[model samples]
Target: MNTVFVVGSLNIDQTIRVPSFPRAGETIRGSDATFSPGGKGANQAVAASRAGAAVRLVGRVGQDAHGAAILQVLAESNIDSSHVKLTDSASTGTAVIAVDDQGENQIILSPGANAALSFADVDAGLATLTPNDVLVLQLEIPRDIVRHAARAAKLCGAFVILNAAPSPLEIEGLFDDIDLLVVNEQEIQDLARLANASGDLAELTETLPSVLGPAVLCTAGAQGAVTFLGRRPVHISAPEVSVADTTAAGDTFVGYLAASLAADRELPAAMAIAGRAASIAVTRPGAVESIPWRHELPTLQDHDTQSAALFLSHP
Candidate 1:
């Protein structure tokens, strides 16, 4: 099995359930507060591990109780935390999330130690990577560090998957060497704006090849996901589930996608598997705690034999 190295953020999400999102400058009384171990990196790491991927996390936390609690959560999830560094200068990364009855969420993040991630941190954290491993990154940290990690992973002959999350302005020239680029609808819009793309999603798809050389996975929440391979596009619909929280849905998708690829599954099949896992994720609350384990994915297990037969026939 290929090892997955995740270099990103670690945050303690303080979530509150509210009647609705408050208007700007308006303070509405919240229902309840819950603290959960989250952050893109930690969520992805937990998701990957739950999906049966051997994942190693590389991130930083503060020398505080919140940081310790986050580490304990990761440990409970069976993720290796040897590379998780603790700093005395900063507090642990934190997020303030407001969730509504419809399972919608709005987040405000305080980067804390996540903002302190440097290239040296990545270099040291990923020292064990080899040619056959996978390097997963997100924009939760600095772009320069993401670039540095990508370069190192490429040099080591590892597959690079960049999840352009929290959106960015410009990411040109960075995706050329990336094996897969995962982005949500808002992120796609952000990229389209950066590349000066006009009109609708079709124009964005048309401009993908010229802008980013790697294959793109566009996640459209409840609508499902679309994968672009050159001029070919494969669409997969998400399964039905009563969503309780949509916080970790995208991270779950990315984790399962990487796990499927690591298992050498084809793109279309992998997308279906990832979509199912994500559907399951949104039905639960919290980020890492919501992701399903590999054995728990019955939809995937039932179709495994069919997929094998199809693969044999096609090849």
Candidate 2:
């Protein structure tokens, strides 16, 4: 089995259910507040482990209750947390989230110890990686550390998957180090803007492989996802389901995708599994709580063959 090393952030999320999003300088009363283990890296690591991958998470936390809670969640999920370091000077990373009844949410993040993660920390964690392993990364950590990890993983001959979330950052030479780039509609737009590539979805998708890499998966919620492989595009429709909370939906997708790929599944097959996992995630509430286990996933009939055919035909 291929191991997955996640070098990213671990945050304690403070979530509140609100009637609607608050406007500028407007205070709105909310329902009872809840705390959950979150952060893109932690959520994705849990998702990957539950999806049947050997996963290890490398990040930083504070010497506080919130940090302990984050480690507890990882331990319960059976993910390796030995690389998660505790700092005395900083508090654990925190995210204040407000979710409306409709499941839309707004978040404010305080990086805290997550920002304190150094390249040395990442290097020590990555030392366990073999060429067959996969390195999963997100933008929640410092850009320099992300760049270093990506470079080191590439040098080690491990496949690197980068989830460019939140937004695009000006990280030099980062794109060249990525094996697979995953992004949502908004993220793709942000990437296109950063790369100065213009056009509609099709045009942009067709142009991305030449600029970003050989593979770029651009997801459009409800509308489905488009896979760009070396100028070829394959469209995969998302499974229709009622959404309860969208928290960690994207993380679930990325996690399942990495798990499937690490298990030697082809890109198309991996993407189908990921899409299904994400479809199931949004039907539940909370972050890690919303992700589905491998046993819980329904078999997709002919999905692999059909998706592969689409991919090949496009090429």
TM, every model: 0.92, 0.94
Judged by lDDT, which candidate is best? 2
| Candidate number with greatest TM-score | 2
lDDT tens string, model 1, 1-315?
A: 688789989999999988899998999998679998899999988888888888899999999988999899889878888889999889999999888988989999999988888777888888989887888889888887888899989988989899988887677566756888898878888887887775444346446756667666778776677766666656676667898999989999888887777777788887888888888989998877888887777655443222222221221
RMSD of 2: 2.8
Off by over 4 Å in 2: 303-315
Off by over 4 Å in 1: 301-315
Candidate 1 local lDDT, residue 174: 67
Q: Where does the lowest 10-residue lDDT sum fall in candidate 2?
A: 306-315
Model 2: per-residue Cα lDDT at residue 152: 94
